[model samples]
Target: MKMKKLLISIVILVLLGIASIYIPIPGYMVITPGEMLNTKEMIQVDQGTKSKGDYYITSFEQGPANAISYLFSFTGIIKVEPMPPLDEQKMDVEKGKADLENSKLSAMTAAIRKAGKDVKYEHKGWEVLKDDTKYGIKKGDLLQAIDGISLKSSEEFFLPDLIKYYEKKKVGDTVTYQILRGEETLEVKTKLVEQNGQKIDDLNLRLSVKQKAEFQSPVKVNFKKLDLGGPSAGLMMTLDILDELLPEDLTKGNKIAGTGTISADGKVGIIGGENYKVLSTIDTGVKVFFCPKENAKLAQETVKKYDIKVKVVPVATLDEAVEYLRNMK
Candidate 1:
């Protein structure tokens, strides 16, 4: 009887250990936006579309352990709000091919350099209202200041942080702006409205000033929704842009997978979560996995250790991925 009881206790302990991985331990459940925010300027912007502004996204950090914590964190919460599909709703991903093509590193760097010298704010893009009347603001338009204060790149200006600081103010509270338009310095006044919606305040309104802005005048935009797990979508975002810029289709309907952070210039950078992503692709029977040059070398080394039937297409930039995809087609 004693031996049988000991075996039962051991099995229970093993089960508990497995369960603990998913259940957030006492210390790890709550994650703040600050934890995920990248303090540096390493982020993508959509310069070619009506929707513009500065935004960044962190990759979804999930595993058996994270998966459980995510579940528990949202256990009793109910969402009545309807959201757009992953590709459509999330500004983090590229909107379409045009956005990717327009967001090239050269273009962005040029904008930033000019803004640094002559303007207080500069970003490749900004969003327009539903009526398409005007953009949030244009590039090269001097953003004299936010909330009646002068701004310099020296001041890390983020919309969410501003709102949080000013949240105590009422709806009619005025956020004064001094704008520079061309050779003329203009003054514009905007009033604060009550915050609505279910998402965090920081994510809802992303504001920035710009010297000037350029966007495609709205050609026929074909959009297909995709399920992208993280920032790795940057590479795919650029390739999709090249496809629109070029004469041919890159994704000829075959399942393609890969991960990397891509610049508008096409340089692919290392992204997070390679191993789990590789495993996901393998399990999903993906045909081609495109990885950044750095990640590709590591992934290749890993693939050789395990028998992976999927073809791994290694690319250094968005152009390379586009070329590979075209060849596959």
Candidate 2:
């Protein structure tokens, strides 16, 4: 009888321990180093040349935190943060997907133009980021027009245009918006608010609907279906596209890794998780890692903190990265 009771107690403890590892604790997320993917395998440019060298994009894993992961955060190898509200999380996921799509488009345009080619773009519509106004506007709604003004135009939408449209109007002015939700087209009314001597509303049209791009060059670029979704790989993808389009070998037969968001005009934007990305390159034979100039300090600090054996190069533009590779010893 004594032996059976002891065995039962041990089993209960074991089951509890396993449960703690698998069950996620709400309101927190765990972030850890992820993978480094070679862009050569991920991107294919038709009518473009293949290079002997390789370009890698770094990534990090994030998910709801479990009890075991929360405990592991103390070791400094991982990070845990309080999760935002559920609605915000959903909005963030949509934004992330949109950003990934935009990144690919921007990379292709930037690379093609840098190679002396032309590319055209059309603004499709506006993506609703917030719907906190008194109106019934909901997040993820496709904003088609405002006060009969079509959002879909040849020119890109800018904040100044939005401001200018509402400039003559005073606070408490109401505007009608035509939005598309699924297959349904609905009209919603929103009221403007005063902020810093400017009249604005929470229509949240800043996040543009995905733009359509047409490349004039014979070279066509397509990305393989990737599990990751974010804009941080934009810079690396642009570099890889350039490598494929140009006759010159940008990699110089060396393994290079990087992370940063690339704009259509070739500017490199800042990204999160630079430190963990640096840690992910350990023992990967990556000679050089490029990051946005804004992240350079933290990336270099992470390299020093972990004694990583890679050089960290900070670049503000695609031209800077190209010039550095051209002059690389």
Candidate 3:
């Protein structure tokens, strides 16, 4: 009887182990599809636009091999590009390279203070481009100050108040502002044109924050500071930045699973960690997988081999992602 009982116990243990293979552990979040970015996002400047004699700290290099540089930097990978010094022609051109819309709008209503014309203009915003500018605004000549208020950091201004007040006027309503340009300060007035036939609710206030970086050029990645420890965190970091800035609720409070690098223009770039990240997220029962377009292919193959049931989507930008999340509800 003792021998029979021991054999039965062994058989029961084997069966339990086999059953565990089919059962999935619970996960923490759900993922959905949006866009597919092709490369890892980093910051780089146009050498033609940049001239010698300006103070610049080489913020990032190019490619996965350069991850070490950021590990030792002051802001880690978060502030990859160092602040560059300003010269006359070079400063004007660099400022122009920022978001065109923001520059145009700001030039009309605000005047940035400076010690002199030689002072480098800089501002703190929620999302700054790599080359350093407000994410959505552009650069232009200033004519006046809006509502007698001076513009400081692009990110700190109150936008809703401006929009609400502007709405009361007709298309040709004249608005006056105190303006400064190239060592001269004067009053300038322009007619406000009513923008119609679009669903634009409010002026993108977040666009004025000028500290965001521009990722048009490739900067090197120093990966030691990343908690995820791979290129996958890049895209997620970009999304996190977007979620932090606008009130649109991009993530909708869901757990977002993605892989890519954050670019200065808010574009998602490609990176490694697809297979590993997929497996890790799968084991936790993740609802969605955000990865590169190329890596998504690998993930699909892995899914077929392992018989995965979860959803995996590739993305290219934060805008696409916001749309995807919005449709899920």
Any idea what lDDT model 3 has? 0.39
- Over 4 Å off, model 2: 121-208, 212-215
Give model 3 RMSD, 1 decimal. Answer: 22.4
Candidate 3, poorest ten consecutive residues by summed lDDT = 51-60
- Order of candidate numbers by lDDT, starting with the best: 2, 1, 3
TM-score for predicted model 3 compared with the true structure: 0.33
True-structure lDDT of candidate 1: 0.44
* Residues 84-186, model 3: lDDT tens digits: 2334235434333433333222221111110011213344233323221422223433323465644433322323345557666566566655544446655
lDDT per residue, candidate 1, 249-327, as tens digits? 4566555666665543346665544543454444444677777665676566555655666677777655576567657
Q: Which candidate achieves the best TM-score against the true structure?
A: 2
Candidate 1 differs from the real structure by a C-alpha RMSD in angstroms, to one decimal, of 14.6
Clash count, one per candidate: 16, 0, 49
For residues 1-329, write the lDDT of model 2, one tens digit per residue: 99999999999999999987879888888999889998888899988887788899998888899988888898777998887678656755776777788788878878988988777644566566555445676777777877887866522233334557888887788888888888999997777876434576545422424554443545689889876777899999999999888989988999999999887778887777898898899999998999988789989998998889999999988999999999998
Report the Cα lDDT for residue 291, model 2: 98
TM-score of each: 0.41, 0.75, 0.33
Query: Would you list the rank order by TM-score, best first?
Result: 2, 1, 3
